[model samples]
Target: MATTNIWQKFKALIPEGSRTIVTITANNGNGTSQAQLRDGSVVTVKGESVQAGLKAFVQGGEIKGTALDLAQYEVEV
Candidate 1:
């Protein structure tokens, strides 16, 4: 018998959220902004220039195959 398994790849770019940890890749202002994770974890990003609309990349996670906001559980950066 041959074991058959299927795997899928998912990718998305999401905006910053309340329970998200974000790092400033590039900031153009005072650079005092920061983010927090849902698990009470934190991460920081420093830069002198930031994009107008900050976004984050998420992947390698299992979804329920439903239409929902995955960013809620993702770290913001």
Candidate 2:
């Protein structure tokens, strides 16, 4: 007899922290900065190296790296 580990299987499909594209809204002058998401909500991210008015990839509340300044579009289903 074998046990069906459904929980583990589902967990494996989920990522620890999905990366997101955000624009640097403001710099706190510290090691952290504020970023605005696609939904227009702002959140603090770890990293001030990237100046404002630029885009970056954030993951787990930290700045993973810089992202290309590309325009985004939304479509209706």
Candidate 3:
């Protein structure tokens, strides 16, 4: 499914008129990808990914435990 569509569906699951803070983090293994959306809870996604802008990546591969800084990401609602 498209990312917008996924977020639209997920929006219904959250309470109305509220804001949610989430971190979209990706951890890739050889030949595959996995991601986590942390909003005080972790929702893992397989075979899908999050997009980060240039310079958003902090460090990777066990260097800093995150690919992007907290300010570089956006959660669509």
Best candidate (score: TM-score): 2
Pick the winner on TM-score between candidates 2 and 3: 2
- How does each model score on TM-score? 0.22, 0.72, 0.23
Off by over 4 Å in 1: 1-29, 47-77
Q: How far in Å is the alpha carbon of 19 misplaced in model 1?
A: 16
lDDT of 1 by residue, 3-72 (tens): 6444322223442332322333333366432323345554443432334234432222111111222444
Instruction: Write the candidate numbers in order of decreasing lDDT.
Output: 2, 3, 1
Q: Is candidate 1 or candidate 3 better by TM-score?
A: 3
Q: What stretches of model 3 exceed 4 Å from their correct place?
A: 1-22, 30-38, 52-77
- What lDDT does each candidate get? 0.34, 0.92, 0.37
Q: Give a tens-digit lDDT track for model 2, residues 14-65.
A: 9788899999999998899999998999999998878899999998999888
Candidate 2 C-alpha error for residue 29, in Å = 1.2
Tens-digit per-residue lDDT, 19-46, candidate 3? 3233444545542233333434444333
The alpha-carbon lDDT assigned to residue 64 of candidate 3 equals 21
Each candidate structure's count of clashing pairs: 8, 0, 0
